[model samples]
Target: MKSKTLLILTGHTKGLGHAILDQFLSLESVQVVALSRSSLDLDLPNVTEFPLDLSDLNALEANLTKFFPKEESFDRYILINNAGWIGEVKQVGKLNPKGIQRVMNLNLLAPMILTDAFV
Candidate 1:
């Protein structure tokens, strides 16, 4: 049987993304596209991994073609925007400006960017 849906899941190497990936693995009708900074420890045949640093907006945009090729077609597309980053926990005054930007870029901007590209 052919895959009927394409699932683009971010942050697949850990936490919530990892759990979601495990569940998706059992579904034979869905093809998974996982993006993460590190490769998944499990070598599942149904999943395709795209190693990416989502926090790097420029790089992410530059690599969009490789992840989302225009030639590939799916009956449906599901994007799980699970990628996020919580920078060092401390008093607001102690937070470094660069660190704050990184957190926002990963936790906020990255999702919108990916969604835009997906659409």
Candidate 2:
């Protein structure tokens, strides 16, 4: 039997993340765990989808274990932190504070927290 390969991906519902997920799913030995604010439409046997908001730091921290459980089951583990939010395109000085915070939380804080939990 082929060894199990686990892939944890964020922002997997569209764009580049979705493309990467498509490529990974083609390999029969790989199992994909996807996290996105919007649920994915894929119904593949090897895919597990988690609809989540990465901007909520408290919820994300509390649920880290649920996303990354004991690693003993897989022969290899891969984490792809592809989720990001590009805040308003205006100048930094004119940017809204709340928007900046939301972007930072999603693009920076969430990935760091997830990476720490995965490692």
Candidate 3:
């Protein structure tokens, strides 16, 4: 069997991410680490789940450091940014600032922070 790899997957609790996780968890070479808004009932053998809110970049970074410290760099690191949201679809003039901000924060900002943390 190939050596195990540390895989970090965001948005893994539903949709495409969920399917990917399902496929990878069966592989002996992959150690899956999933981050989702709520705990999921995935009973894969080599999978670890983290209840996370990706909107909080600082907390995400801190937790990443705690989970994958410098000393644990031997395993491969993979981050999938699949979380996204669509705010009120209205004319520009009628757009809600708060709604747009929340969507951007979750879709764009969180991915950027994850990329930085991975690097």
Give the clash count for each candidate.
Answer: 0, 0, 0
- What lDDT tens digits, residue by residue, belong to model 1 across residues 23-103? 989998877889999996557766889889898999889887776646667888999999888889999689999899889
TM-score of each: 0.89, 0.90, 0.81
In model 2, where do residues sit more than 4 Å from their true spots?
A: 69-72
For residue 30, model 1's alpha carbon misses the true position, in angstroms, by 1.2
Best by lDDT: 2
lDDT of each: 0.87, 0.88, 0.76
Candidate 3 per-residue lDDT, tens place, 10-60, comes to 888889988888888778777777888887976777777888877776677
Question: Where is model 1 more than 4 Å wrong at Cα?
Answer: 1-3, 69-71
User: Looking at model 2, which ten-residue stretch has the lowest summed lDDT?
Assistant: 63-72
Q: Could you list the CA RMSD of all candidates, in the order they appear?
A: 1.8, 1.7, 2.3
Clashing pairs in 2: none
Per-residue lDDT of candidate 2, residues 51-114 (tens digit):
8899988888877887754654888999999999887899757989988889999999999998
Looking at model 1, residue 88 earns an lDDT score of 90
